[model samples]
Target: MKRLIPLLLLAAVPALAAPVAAPHVAARSFEQLAKPLPLPYAEGADADAAVAAAKARARQAHKLLLIDLGGNWCLDCRLLAGTIELPDLNGWVKRHYEVVTVDVGRFDKNGQIPAHYGITGRLAGVPAVLVVDPRTDRLVNKGHETALSDARSLTPQALADWLARWV
Candidate 1:
């Protein structure tokens, strides 16, 4: 059993180490991304409202929290959001930090967001998950792309790892 454990991990490493859809997204051009992207959640709530509440919660919480710097209009953002909110992944996430999401489109014009974090000119991609310190507004972690776009490819697990950096 012990000897086979190495083999088991070896077998799993390739599957887990890289994303399945990375190549497709990495190869895509800006024109490909110009279309509508899907997201896990609705643009149901206001971005500032959501962030305000999450930041308020983080004020009292002692864990390292994440501020997802993306929006519901993005594919990579949606994929990452769905993964983190999954039962098992959320279990791990809740253990380490609080979470909030910022809408790149709406928040960019505000002074609260840095110019570098702006999703302008080029395609910002929906799910550029940026981990930040809610208390201090310092950036801690971020992920760029997923299989949805050609310029960047990201998988759920790969996205989770990036969010893990914030946690």
Candidate 2:
């Protein structure tokens, strides 16, 4: 009876834990992604204004603010941007986040964006994703900002999974 009680308690543990949501991805592989991945960064646009607008929208919509800091020249940044725009993932992202892209040209421009979230010094790389909570205006994923810096190495589903984690 004692052994059976322990087994029953062990079984209950799984039920008590939170369930992880599966990533929504349309593409099965990276090769299947659309040709000439999108150049999302707008060097000519005002990044500060864009971020402020996004934050306001996020607060009003009760969604998280997703700041995508990268340059058009970075292949990994483009890959990450392309993956996020995938049909299935795009819808999910739109539902949960107000996204803004800031062009950090060769890590020289838009230094204030990351600094606003207390990320000082040299960035790890391009495609630094900042997930901010609209209510508090705090960075949710602090240390993991550069997690997708090497987007080329991740599968489409893996990229979606990474974004889903913040949601």
Candidate 3:
């Protein structure tokens, strides 16, 4: 009977361990931090027109144009988007850069945007960011376009610091 009781308890162990849901942070919006989260990338969108409009807006606003190059399918891209959408950071981005999301679908679509910035090949990874000075259309942070590529590993503070540096 003792051995049978032990075996019964062992058999119930899996049932006893219930799955736990992650605790939600109060400040994060539903759209900002949802699972398979909502990102701001437009698939098959025209990068040229987007850039041109952003350039005009940046020129008028006297701000840099921040081109977020990635697809909606990328988790890192979505993470970066969510990080930037944080209330404080969102205001900073609006003040300093005219943000544009250029969707590079599986490294297939929207290759021209980066090419326009003189990068001939496909990017090192998704969420390749390009901060361009509207006045000269220069790539301000040339090699660091993939700074946010490792969004999964970066802390919110690190991302904020990176954004602040360019501003």
| Residue-level lDDT tens digits of model 1 in 12-106 | 85425543221112212223332344354435456566666776777677555555556565555655555555554667677666776656554
Candidate 2 per-residue lDDT, tens place, 47-152, comes to 9899999999999998889999999999889888888878888888888889999999998888999999999977899899999998889998989999999888
Best by lDDT: 2
Which residue pairs in candidate 3 collide?
none
Using TM-score as the measure, which candidate wins? 2
Error of 3 at 157 (Å): 1.3
TM-score ranking from best candidate downward: 2, 3, 1
Q: Which residue pairs clash within candidate 2? A: none
Question: Model 1, stretches more than 4 Å misplaced?
Answer: 1-44, 71-73, 104-123, 142-152
Measured on C-alpha atoms, candidate 1 has an lDDT of 0.51
Q: What is the C-alpha lDDT of each candidate?
A: 0.51, 0.88, 0.79
Cα RMSD for candidate 1? 10.4
Cα error, candidate 1, residue 58 (Å): 1.4
